[model samples]
Target: MSGLTVRHPHPSDHAALQGALTDWWGGMGGEAGAQQRRLLVPRLFLQHFAGTSLLVEEPEPAGTRGGAALRAFLIGFLSQTDPDTAYIHFVGVHPEAQRGGLGSALYQRFFDLVREHGRSRVRSITSPVNRNSIAYHTRMGFRIEAGDRTEDGVEVHTDYDGPGLDRVSFVREL
Candidate 1:
Protein backbone atom coordinates (compact mmCIF):
# COMPACT_ATOMS: atom_id res chain seq x y z
CA MET A 1 0.00 0.00 0.00
CA SER A 2 3.01 2.23 -0.22
CA GLY A 3 2.41 5.39 -2.23
CA LEU A 4 -1.32 4.90 -1.72
CA THR A 5 -3.28 6.72 0.93
CA VAL A 6 -6.03 5.40 3.17
CA ARG A 7 -8.46 7.98 4.51
CA HIS A 8 -12.03 8.65 5.54
CA PRO A 9 -14.57 8.15 2.79
CA HIS A 10 -15.69 11.45 1.32
CA PRO A 11 -19.47 11.88 1.07
CA SER A 12 -19.38 12.16 -2.69
CA ASP A 13 -17.41 8.95 -2.91
CA HIS A 14 -20.43 6.76 -2.20
CA ALA A 15 -21.67 6.55 -5.76
CA ALA A 16 -18.28 5.50 -7.03
CA LEU A 17 -17.88 2.89 -4.33
CA GLN A 18 -21.34 1.57 -5.08
CA GLY A 19 -20.34 1.28 -8.70
CA ALA A 20 -17.20 -0.58 -7.76
CA LEU A 21 -19.19 -3.02 -5.62
CA THR A 22 -21.60 -3.67 -8.45
CA ASP A 23 -18.80 -4.23 -10.89
CA TRP A 24 -16.69 -6.36 -8.63
CA TRP A 25 -19.39 -8.78 -7.57
CA GLY A 26 -21.31 -8.63 -10.80
CA GLY A 27 -18.34 -10.43 -12.26
CA MET A 28 -19.10 -13.53 -10.20
CA GLY A 29 -22.45 -14.69 -11.67
CA GLY A 30 -26.03 -13.58 -12.15
CA GLU A 31 -27.25 -14.67 -8.74
CA ALA A 32 -24.17 -13.41 -7.00
CA GLY A 33 -24.38 -10.15 -8.92
CA ALA A 34 -27.94 -9.49 -7.82
CA GLN A 35 -27.17 -10.40 -4.21
CA GLN A 36 -24.09 -8.20 -4.19
CA ARG A 37 -25.91 -5.18 -5.54
CA ARG A 38 -28.50 -5.60 -2.80
CA LEU A 39 -25.80 -5.44 -0.15
CA LEU A 40 -24.82 -1.83 -0.51
CA VAL A 41 -26.31 0.78 1.83
CA PRO A 42 -23.43 3.22 1.85
CA ARG A 43 -25.11 6.40 3.03
CA LEU A 44 -25.48 5.34 6.65
CA PHE A 45 -21.77 4.88 7.01
CA LEU A 46 -20.62 7.82 4.92
CA GLN A 47 -22.97 10.25 6.61
CA HIS A 48 -21.96 9.48 10.18
CA PHE A 49 -18.78 7.40 10.17
CA ALA A 50 -16.44 9.06 7.74
CA GLY A 51 -13.68 8.85 10.31
CA THR A 52 -14.12 5.19 11.14
CA SER A 53 -14.68 3.87 7.63
CA LEU A 54 -11.98 3.90 5.00
CA LEU A 55 -11.09 4.18 1.31
CA VAL A 56 -7.80 3.64 -0.45
CA GLU A 57 -6.89 4.69 -3.95
CA GLU A 58 -3.92 4.40 -6.27
CA PRO A 59 -3.02 6.03 -9.54
CA GLU A 60 -5.14 4.51 -12.27
CA PRO A 61 -2.16 3.62 -14.38
CA ALA A 62 0.63 5.46 -16.17
CA GLY A 63 -1.63 6.73 -18.93
CA THR A 64 -5.10 6.84 -17.45
CA ARG A 65 -6.89 10.17 -17.26
CA GLY A 66 -8.59 9.59 -13.92
CA GLY A 67 -7.00 10.44 -10.57
CA ALA A 68 -6.71 6.82 -9.43
CA ALA A 69 -8.64 3.59 -9.21
CA LEU A 70 -10.65 3.11 -6.05
CA ARG A 71 -9.05 -0.22 -5.18
CA ALA A 72 -10.78 -1.04 -1.91
CA PHE A 73 -13.08 0.24 0.85
CA LEU A 74 -14.39 -0.66 4.31
CA ILE A 75 -17.55 0.63 5.99
CA GLY A 76 -17.57 0.26 9.76
CA PHE A 77 -17.92 2.04 13.08
CA LEU A 78 -17.63 1.89 16.85
CA SER A 79 -20.40 -0.47 17.94
CA GLN A 80 -23.34 0.85 19.93
CA THR A 81 -23.25 -2.38 21.94
CA ASP A 82 -22.46 -1.90 25.64
CA PRO A 83 -18.79 -2.70 25.13
CA ASP A 84 -18.29 -0.25 22.30
CA THR A 85 -16.48 -2.60 19.93
CA ALA A 86 -15.71 -1.56 16.39
CA TYR A 87 -18.04 -3.16 13.86
CA ILE A 88 -17.14 -3.52 10.22
CA HIS A 89 -20.18 -3.37 8.02
CA PHE A 90 -18.87 -4.01 4.53
CA VAL A 91 -15.65 -4.43 2.62
CA GLY A 92 -14.73 -4.78 -1.04
CA VAL A 93 -11.51 -5.39 -2.87
CA HIS A 94 -11.71 -4.58 -6.55
CA PRO A 95 -11.50 -7.73 -8.66
CA GLU A 96 -8.32 -6.58 -10.33
CA ALA A 97 -6.80 -5.97 -6.91
CA GLN A 98 -7.84 -9.09 -5.09
CA ARG A 99 -5.24 -11.53 -3.62
CA GLY A 100 -2.67 -8.79 -3.21
CA GLY A 101 -3.12 -8.27 0.52
CA LEU A 102 -5.15 -5.08 -0.05
CA GLY A 103 -7.91 -6.33 2.23
CA SER A 104 -5.53 -6.79 5.14
CA ALA A 105 -3.99 -3.43 4.45
CA LEU A 106 -7.37 -1.75 4.66
CA TYR A 107 -8.02 -3.39 8.03
CA GLN A 108 -4.64 -2.45 9.40
CA ARG A 109 -5.24 1.16 8.41
CA PHE A 110 -8.60 1.18 10.17
CA PHE A 111 -7.08 -0.39 13.25
CA ASP A 112 -4.48 2.32 13.36
CA LEU A 113 -7.21 4.93 13.10
CA VAL A 114 -9.26 3.56 16.01
CA ARG A 115 -6.62 2.04 18.27
CA GLU A 116 -6.90 4.95 20.68
CA HIS A 117 -10.68 4.76 21.04
CA GLY A 118 -10.60 2.29 23.99
CA ARG A 119 -12.24 -0.50 22.04
CA SER A 120 -10.86 -4.01 22.49
CA ARG A 121 -12.73 -5.80 19.78
CA VAL A 122 -13.58 -5.43 16.10
CA ARG A 123 -16.50 -7.46 14.89
CA SER A 124 -18.25 -8.40 11.64
CA ILE A 125 -20.73 -10.95 10.39
CA THR A 126 -21.16 -12.79 7.11
CA SER A 127 -23.48 -15.33 5.60
CA PRO A 128 -22.54 -18.77 6.93
CA VAL A 129 -22.15 -20.11 3.43
CA ASN A 130 -19.75 -17.44 2.30
CA ARG A 131 -16.76 -19.62 3.05
CA ASN A 132 -14.42 -17.26 1.27
CA SER A 133 -15.30 -14.48 3.68
CA ILE A 134 -15.07 -16.80 6.63
CA ALA A 135 -11.64 -17.95 5.52
CA TYR A 136 -10.48 -14.43 4.86
CA HIS A 137 -11.69 -13.18 8.21
CA THR A 138 -10.07 -16.14 9.89
CA ARG A 139 -6.79 -15.42 8.20
CA MET A 140 -7.12 -11.87 9.37
CA GLY A 141 -7.43 -13.11 12.98
CA PHE A 142 -11.20 -13.03 13.58
CA ARG A 143 -12.83 -15.88 15.45
CA ILE A 144 -15.72 -17.39 13.54
CA GLU A 145 -18.89 -18.17 15.47
CA ALA A 146 -21.69 -20.30 14.14
CA GLY A 147 -25.19 -20.23 15.61
CA ASP A 148 -28.26 -18.01 15.96
CA ARG A 149 -28.26 -15.34 18.63
CA THR A 150 -30.41 -12.36 19.52
CA GLU A 151 -29.01 -8.95 18.89
CA ASP A 152 -30.41 -5.53 19.73
CA GLY A 153 -33.72 -7.12 20.73
CA VAL A 154 -34.24 -8.69 17.36
CA GLU A 155 -34.34 -12.44 16.94
CA VAL A 156 -31.36 -13.12 14.74
CA HIS A 157 -33.34 -16.10 13.65
CA THR A 158 -31.78 -18.66 11.39
CA ASP A 159 -31.05 -17.16 8.01
CA TYR A 160 -31.29 -13.73 9.55
CA ASP A 161 -31.18 -12.28 6.05
CA GLY A 162 -33.48 -14.77 4.40
CA PRO A 163 -34.20 -18.47 3.92
CA GLY A 164 -31.10 -20.65 4.28
CA LEU A 165 -29.04 -17.56 5.03
CA ASP A 166 -27.73 -18.04 8.54
CA ARG A 167 -24.95 -15.73 9.62
CA VAL A 168 -21.48 -16.42 11.00
CA SER A 169 -20.38 -13.80 13.47
CA PHE A 170 -16.71 -12.96 13.83
CA VAL A 171 -14.77 -11.07 16.48
CA ARG A 172 -11.15 -9.96 16.61
CA GLU A 173 -9.50 -8.44 19.64
CA LEU A 174 -7.99 -5.08 18.92
Candidate 2:
Protein backbone atom coordinates (compact mmCIF):
# COMPACT_ATOMS: atom_id res chain seq x y z
CA MET A 1 0.00 0.00 0.00
CA SER A 2 1.84 3.03 -1.32
CA GLY A 3 0.69 6.47 -2.31
CA LEU A 4 -1.04 6.64 -5.69
CA THR A 5 0.07 9.38 -8.04
CA VAL A 6 -2.32 10.65 -10.70
CA ARG A 7 -0.97 12.61 -13.62
CA HIS A 8 -1.34 13.17 -17.34
CA PRO A 9 -0.36 10.26 -19.57
CA HIS A 10 2.62 10.31 -21.84
CA PRO A 11 2.73 8.88 -25.35
CA SER A 12 5.21 6.24 -24.25
CA ASP A 13 2.61 4.76 -21.89
CA HIS A 14 0.23 3.79 -24.69
CA ALA A 15 1.42 0.24 -25.15
CA ALA A 16 1.44 -0.51 -21.43
CA LEU A 17 -2.03 0.93 -21.06
CA GLN A 18 -3.27 -1.14 -24.00
CA GLY A 19 -1.84 -4.28 -22.47
CA ALA A 20 -3.58 -3.51 -19.20
CA LEU A 21 -6.87 -3.03 -20.99
CA THR A 22 -6.48 -6.32 -22.84
CA ASP A 23 -5.83 -8.11 -19.61
CA TRP A 24 -8.69 -6.34 -17.87
CA TRP A 25 -11.30 -7.10 -20.53
CA GLY A 26 -9.97 -10.53 -21.39
CA GLY A 27 -10.49 -11.53 -17.81
CA MET A 28 -14.14 -10.65 -18.29
CA GLY A 29 -14.44 -12.72 -21.46
CA GLY A 30 -11.90 -13.53 -24.20
CA GLU A 31 -9.73 -12.05 -26.92
CA ALA A 32 -12.64 -11.35 -29.24
CA GLY A 33 -14.35 -8.95 -26.85
CA ALA A 34 -11.00 -7.69 -25.77
CA GLN A 35 -10.31 -6.74 -29.35
CA GLN A 36 -13.47 -4.68 -29.35
CA ARG A 37 -12.32 -3.04 -26.14
CA ARG A 38 -8.94 -2.19 -27.63
CA LEU A 39 -10.51 -0.07 -30.32
CA LEU A 40 -11.79 2.38 -27.74
CA VAL A 41 -8.39 3.15 -26.25
CA PRO A 42 -6.83 4.65 -29.36
CA ARG A 43 -9.79 6.90 -29.99
CA LEU A 44 -10.03 8.03 -26.42
CA PHE A 45 -6.30 8.50 -26.12
CA LEU A 46 -6.26 10.62 -29.20
CA GLN A 47 -9.24 12.64 -28.10
CA HIS A 48 -8.12 13.08 -24.53
CA PHE A 49 -4.39 13.39 -24.86
CA ALA A 50 -4.76 15.31 -28.01
CA GLY A 51 -3.57 16.96 -24.94
CA THR A 52 -5.17 15.39 -21.83
CA SER A 53 -5.40 11.89 -20.34
CA LEU A 54 -4.80 10.93 -16.72
CA LEU A 55 -2.79 8.02 -15.39
CA VAL A 56 -2.57 6.53 -11.91
CA GLU A 57 0.57 4.87 -10.62
CA GLU A 58 1.51 3.19 -7.37
CA PRO A 59 5.08 2.61 -6.33
CA GLU A 60 6.24 -0.83 -5.35
CA PRO A 61 9.20 -1.76 -3.15
CA ALA A 62 12.38 -0.87 -5.02
CA GLY A 63 14.00 -4.28 -5.24
CA THR A 64 12.52 -6.76 -7.83
CA ARG A 65 9.08 -5.39 -7.18
CA GLY A 66 8.50 -4.02 -10.69
CA GLY A 67 8.84 -0.43 -9.60
CA ALA A 68 5.66 1.54 -10.28
CA ALA A 69 2.73 -0.13 -11.92
CA LEU A 70 -0.08 1.75 -13.55
CA ARG A 71 -3.13 0.99 -11.42
CA ALA A 72 -5.92 2.95 -13.08
CA PHE A 73 -6.44 5.47 -15.84
CA LEU A 74 -9.05 7.90 -17.10
CA ILE A 75 -9.00 8.97 -20.72
CA GLY A 76 -11.15 11.98 -21.55
CA PHE A 77 -11.04 15.56 -22.73
CA LEU A 78 -12.36 18.96 -21.89
CA SER A 79 -15.50 19.47 -23.95
CA GLN A 80 -17.20 22.52 -25.34
CA THR A 81 -20.65 21.13 -24.62
CA ASP A 82 -20.70 23.62 -21.78
CA PRO A 83 -17.09 24.79 -21.73
CA ASP A 84 -17.54 23.63 -18.17
CA THR A 85 -17.94 19.99 -19.06
CA ALA A 86 -15.43 17.17 -18.99
CA TYR A 87 -16.52 14.17 -20.98
CA ILE A 88 -14.92 11.01 -19.62
CA HIS A 89 -14.07 8.90 -22.58
CA PHE A 90 -12.97 5.80 -20.69
CA VAL A 91 -11.91 4.70 -17.19
CA GLY A 92 -10.46 1.41 -15.96
CA VAL A 93 -8.75 0.10 -12.89
CA HIS A 94 -6.40 -2.84 -13.43
CA PRO A 95 -8.21 -6.03 -12.44
CA GLU A 96 -5.72 -6.91 -9.72
CA ALA A 97 -6.11 -3.44 -8.23
CA GLN A 98 -9.87 -3.14 -8.11
CA ARG A 99 -11.58 -2.34 -4.76
CA GLY A 100 -8.47 -0.68 -3.44
CA GLY A 101 -9.93 2.84 -3.73
CA LEU A 102 -7.64 3.57 -6.67
CA GLY A 103 -10.58 4.11 -9.01
CA SER A 104 -12.12 6.70 -6.76
CA ALA A 105 -8.78 8.41 -6.33
CA LEU A 106 -8.24 8.48 -10.06
CA TYR A 107 -11.67 10.03 -10.61
CA GLN A 108 -11.27 12.54 -7.83
CA ARG A 109 -8.06 13.64 -9.49
CA PHE A 110 -9.86 13.81 -12.81
CA PHE A 111 -12.59 15.98 -11.32
CA ASP A 112 -10.01 18.21 -9.71
CA LEU A 113 -8.24 18.53 -13.04
CA VAL A 114 -11.55 19.34 -14.68
CA ARG A 115 -12.33 21.96 -12.09
CA GLU A 116 -8.93 23.51 -12.61
CA HIS A 117 -9.95 23.96 -16.20
CA GLY A 118 -13.20 25.50 -15.00
CA ARG A 119 -15.35 22.51 -15.87
CA SER A 120 -18.55 21.98 -13.94
CA ARG A 121 -19.69 18.57 -15.14
CA VAL A 122 -18.24 15.16 -15.83
CA ARG A 123 -19.90 12.53 -17.99
CA SER A 124 -19.26 8.85 -18.59
CA ILE A 125 -20.92 5.68 -19.86
CA THR A 126 -20.77 2.02 -18.93
CA SER A 127 -21.99 -1.18 -20.47
CA PRO A 128 -25.50 -2.13 -19.40
CA VAL A 129 -24.36 -5.56 -18.31
CA ASN A 130 -21.30 -4.34 -16.43
CA ARG A 131 -22.81 -4.19 -13.01
CA ASN A 132 -19.48 -3.56 -11.41
CA SER A 133 -18.87 -0.46 -13.48
CA ILE A 134 -22.39 0.80 -12.83
CA ALA A 135 -21.94 0.25 -9.13
CA TYR A 136 -18.61 2.03 -9.14
CA HIS A 137 -20.02 5.00 -11.00
CA THR A 138 -23.03 5.18 -8.72
CA ARG A 139 -20.78 5.02 -5.69
CA MET A 140 -18.78 7.89 -7.14
CA GLY A 141 -21.98 9.95 -7.29
CA PHE A 142 -22.91 9.67 -10.95
CA ARG A 143 -26.55 9.49 -11.97
CA ILE A 144 -28.14 7.81 -14.95
CA GLU A 145 -28.57 10.28 -17.76
CA ALA A 146 -29.84 8.23 -20.64
CA GLY A 147 -31.58 4.91 -21.16
CA ASP A 148 -29.73 1.95 -22.57
CA ARG A 149 -28.62 2.20 -26.17
CA THR A 150 -26.86 0.01 -28.71
CA GLU A 151 -24.76 0.60 -31.76
CA ASP A 152 -25.52 -1.05 -35.06
CA GLY A 153 -22.82 -3.72 -35.53
CA VAL A 154 -21.03 -1.79 -38.22
CA GLU A 155 -20.01 1.12 -36.04
CA VAL A 156 -17.18 1.25 -33.50
CA HIS A 157 -18.99 2.22 -30.36
CA THR A 158 -16.90 3.71 -27.55
CA ASP A 159 -17.70 5.39 -24.26
CA TYR A 160 -17.98 8.81 -25.78
CA ASP A 161 -20.62 7.50 -28.08
CA GLY A 162 -23.13 8.13 -25.32
CA PRO A 163 -23.88 4.64 -24.04
CA GLY A 164 -23.76 3.26 -27.56
CA LEU A 165 -22.34 -0.14 -26.75
CA ASP A 166 -25.35 -1.69 -25.12
CA ARG A 167 -24.86 0.67 -22.24
CA VAL A 168 -26.28 3.65 -20.43
CA SER A 169 -24.91 7.15 -19.89
CA PHE A 170 -24.22 8.58 -16.45
CA VAL A 171 -23.33 12.11 -15.41
CA ARG A 172 -22.23 13.99 -12.31
CA GLU A 173 -21.99 17.69 -11.82
CA LEU A 174 -18.70 18.95 -10.48
Candidate 3:
Protein backbone atom coordinates (compact mmCIF):
# COMPACT_ATOMS: atom_id res chain seq x y z
CA MET A 1 0.00 0.00 0.00
CA SER A 2 1.23 3.47 -0.86
CA GLY A 3 0.30 6.91 0.33
CA LEU A 4 -3.01 8.23 -1.01
CA THR A 5 -3.13 11.69 -2.52
CA VAL A 6 -6.34 13.71 -2.88
CA ARG A 7 -6.82 16.44 -5.44
CA HIS A 8 -9.21 17.86 -8.00
CA PRO A 9 -9.74 15.63 -11.01
CA HIS A 10 -8.50 16.53 -14.47
CA PRO A 11 -10.81 16.20 -17.45
CA SER A 12 -8.80 13.25 -18.77
CA ASP A 13 -9.53 11.40 -15.53
CA HIS A 14 -13.24 11.20 -16.35
CA ALA A 15 -13.18 7.83 -18.09
CA ALA A 16 -11.41 6.05 -15.26
CA LEU A 17 -13.61 7.71 -12.66
CA GLN A 18 -16.68 6.64 -14.57
CA GLY A 19 -15.39 3.08 -14.86
CA ALA A 20 -14.76 2.85 -11.13
CA LEU A 21 -18.21 4.18 -10.30
CA THR A 22 -19.82 1.88 -12.86
CA ASP A 23 -18.09 -1.08 -11.25
CA TRP A 24 -19.19 -0.03 -7.77
CA TRP A 25 -22.80 0.27 -8.85
CA GLY A 26 -22.77 -2.96 -10.83
CA GLY A 27 -21.46 -4.79 -7.82
CA MET A 28 -24.39 -3.41 -5.88
CA GLY A 29 -26.72 -4.71 -8.61
CA GLY A 30 -26.77 -4.72 -12.42
CA GLU A 31 -27.07 -2.51 -15.50
CA ALA A 32 -30.14 -0.70 -14.24
CA GLY A 33 -28.39 0.19 -11.01
CA ALA A 34 -25.13 1.01 -12.77
CA GLN A 35 -26.98 3.27 -15.18
CA GLN A 36 -28.48 5.19 -12.30
CA ARG A 37 -25.02 5.89 -10.90
CA ARG A 38 -23.77 6.55 -14.43
CA LEU A 39 -25.94 9.63 -14.56
CA LEU A 40 -24.14 11.20 -11.60
CA VAL A 41 -20.56 11.03 -12.94
CA PRO A 42 -21.02 13.31 -15.91
CA ARG A 43 -22.80 15.75 -13.68
CA LEU A 44 -19.89 15.58 -11.25
CA PHE A 45 -17.47 16.20 -14.10
CA LEU A 46 -19.54 19.09 -15.31
CA GLN A 47 -19.48 20.59 -11.81
CA HIS A 48 -15.72 20.17 -11.58
CA PHE A 49 -15.34 21.68 -15.03
CA ALA A 50 -17.50 24.58 -13.91
CA GLY A 51 -15.36 25.07 -10.81
CA THR A 52 -18.14 24.11 -8.42
CA SER A 53 -17.11 20.54 -7.56
CA LEU A 54 -14.16 18.70 -6.05
CA LEU A 55 -12.78 15.34 -7.27
CA VAL A 56 -10.21 13.62 -5.05
CA GLU A 57 -7.87 10.94 -6.32
CA GLU A 58 -5.50 8.33 -4.90
CA PRO A 59 -2.62 7.86 -7.27
CA GLU A 60 -1.15 4.38 -7.71
CA PRO A 61 1.91 3.71 -5.58
CA ALA A 62 5.09 5.39 -6.70
CA GLY A 63 7.29 3.47 -9.19
CA THR A 64 4.14 2.04 -10.80
CA ARG A 65 2.69 4.49 -13.25
CA GLY A 66 -0.10 4.51 -15.75
CA GLY A 67 -3.39 6.21 -15.15
CA ALA A 68 -3.70 6.29 -11.36
CA ALA A 69 -6.96 4.62 -10.46
CA LEU A 70 -9.45 6.84 -8.65
CA ARG A 71 -9.92 5.16 -5.27
CA ALA A 72 -12.61 7.43 -3.83
CA PHE A 73 -14.49 10.63 -4.70
CA LEU A 74 -17.02 13.17 -3.43
CA ILE A 75 -18.96 15.51 -5.65
CA GLY A 76 -20.96 18.59 -4.68
CA PHE A 77 -20.78 22.35 -4.45
CA LEU A 78 -20.88 25.25 -2.10
CA SER A 79 -24.54 25.88 -1.43
CA GLN A 80 -26.56 28.83 -2.64
CA THR A 81 -29.14 28.39 0.11
CA ASP A 82 -26.34 29.30 2.48
CA PRO A 83 -23.10 30.59 1.10
CA ASP A 84 -21.36 28.95 4.03
CA THR A 85 -22.79 25.52 3.25
CA ALA A 86 -21.05 22.81 1.26
CA TYR A 87 -23.29 20.21 -0.28
CA ILE A 88 -22.09 16.71 -1.15
CA HIS A 89 -23.74 15.22 -4.18
CA PHE A 90 -22.16 11.79 -4.03
CA VAL A 91 -19.30 9.81 -2.48
CA GLY A 92 -17.96 6.29 -3.05
CA VAL A 93 -14.95 4.01 -2.83
CA HIS A 94 -14.15 1.17 -5.20
CA PRO A 95 -15.37 -2.09 -3.62
CA GLU A 96 -11.96 -3.71 -3.90
CA ALA A 97 -10.43 -0.77 -2.04
CA GLN A 98 -12.71 -0.73 0.98
CA ARG A 99 -11.34 -1.09 4.56
CA GLY A 100 -8.30 0.97 3.60
CA GLY A 101 -9.91 4.21 4.85
CA LEU A 102 -10.25 5.68 1.37
CA GLY A 103 -13.81 6.81 1.97
CA SER A 104 -12.97 8.53 5.25
CA ALA A 105 -9.86 10.05 3.74
CA LEU A 106 -11.89 11.45 0.87
CA TYR A 107 -14.41 12.97 3.26
CA GLN A 108 -11.71 14.50 5.41
CA ARG A 109 -10.12 16.04 2.35
CA PHE A 110 -13.43 17.48 1.20
CA PHE A 111 -14.26 18.73 4.67
CA ASP A 112 -10.93 20.50 4.93
CA LEU A 113 -11.47 22.07 1.55
CA VAL A 114 -14.87 23.28 2.58
CA ARG A 115 -13.55 24.69 5.82
CA GLU A 116 -10.74 26.41 3.98
CA HIS A 117 -13.41 28.09 1.91
CA GLY A 118 -15.13 29.14 5.20
CA ARG A 119 -18.08 26.86 4.86
CA SER A 120 -19.92 25.84 8.04
CA ARG A 121 -22.07 22.94 6.88
CA VAL A 122 -21.84 19.92 4.59
CA ARG A 123 -24.92 18.26 3.18
CA SER A 124 -25.61 15.16 1.07
CA ILE A 125 -28.26 12.71 -0.01
CA THR A 126 -28.52 8.98 -0.60
CA SER A 127 -31.28 6.56 -1.39
CA PRO A 128 -33.12 5.31 1.68
CA VAL A 129 -32.77 1.79 0.35
CA ASN A 130 -29.01 2.10 0.30
CA ARG A 131 -28.46 1.05 3.88
CA ASN A 132 -24.73 0.89 3.44
CA SER A 133 -24.56 4.51 2.30
CA ILE A 134 -26.80 5.61 5.12
CA ALA A 135 -24.60 3.84 7.63
CA TYR A 136 -21.45 5.35 6.20
CA HIS A 137 -22.90 8.85 6.27
CA THR A 138 -24.05 8.42 9.82
CA ARG A 139 -20.65 7.17 10.86
CA MET A 140 -19.15 10.26 9.30
CA GLY A 141 -21.38 12.46 11.53
CA PHE A 142 -24.16 13.38 9.13
CA ARG A 143 -27.59 13.69 10.65
CA ILE A 144 -30.89 12.90 8.99
CA GLU A 145 -32.49 16.10 7.91
CA ALA A 146 -36.21 16.32 8.43
CA GLY A 147 -38.41 16.51 5.33
CA ASP A 148 -35.99 14.27 3.46
CA ARG A 149 -37.64 11.68 1.25
CA THR A 150 -37.47 10.02 -2.12
CA GLU A 151 -39.39 11.74 -4.86
CA ASP A 152 -41.42 8.59 -5.13
CA GLY A 153 -44.50 9.84 -6.90
CA VAL A 154 -42.97 12.78 -8.63
CA GLU A 155 -42.21 12.38 -12.31
CA VAL A 156 -38.63 11.41 -12.96
CA HIS A 157 -36.40 14.35 -13.71
CA THR A 158 -36.48 14.85 -17.48
CA ASP A 159 -32.82 13.96 -17.51
CA TYR A 160 -33.25 10.73 -15.61
CA ASP A 161 -33.30 7.47 -17.62
CA GLY A 162 -33.35 4.72 -15.00
CA PRO A 163 -36.00 3.39 -12.69
CA GLY A 164 -37.03 6.32 -10.52
CA LEU A 165 -35.21 6.15 -7.21
CA ASP A 166 -35.97 8.15 -4.10
CA ARG A 167 -33.22 9.80 -2.06
CA VAL A 168 -32.93 11.22 1.44
CA SER A 169 -30.86 14.15 2.46
CA PHE A 170 -28.24 14.14 5.24
CA VAL A 171 -26.31 16.98 6.77
CA ARG A 172 -23.30 17.66 9.02
CA GLU A 173 -22.23 20.94 10.55
CA LEU A 174 -18.55 21.60 10.06
List ranges where model 1 is wrong by over 4 Å.
29-32, 35-39, 148-157, 162-164
**Candidate 1 overall lDDT versus native:** 0.77
Per-residue lDDT over 94-160 for candidate 3, one digit per residue giving the tens place of the 0 to 100 score? 7778878777877887788789889989988776667788778889999866652334432112222
Q: Candidate 2 — which residues are off by over 4 angstroms?
A: 43-51, 60-67, 148-164
Colliding residue pairs in candidate 1: 159-165
Model 3 residue pairs with clashes: none
In candidate 2, what are the lDDT values of residues 92-111, reduced to their tens digit?
A: 88878888877787788788
User: 23-87 in candidate 1: lDDT tens per residue?
Assistant: 77746546676456546555767889988998989876777786877889998888776455888
TM-score computed on alpha carbons, candidate 1: 0.83
Candidate 1 vs candidate 2: the lDDT winner is 1
Largest lDDT belongs to which candidate? Answer: 1
- Superposed by TM-score, candidate 1 places the C-alpha of residue 95 at a distance from the truth, in angstroms, of 1.6
The CA lDDT at 126 in model 3 is 73
List the candidates' TM-scores in order. Answer: 0.83, 0.80, 0.78
> What is the C-alpha local distance difference test score of each model?
0.77, 0.74, 0.69
Top candidate, metric TM-score: 1
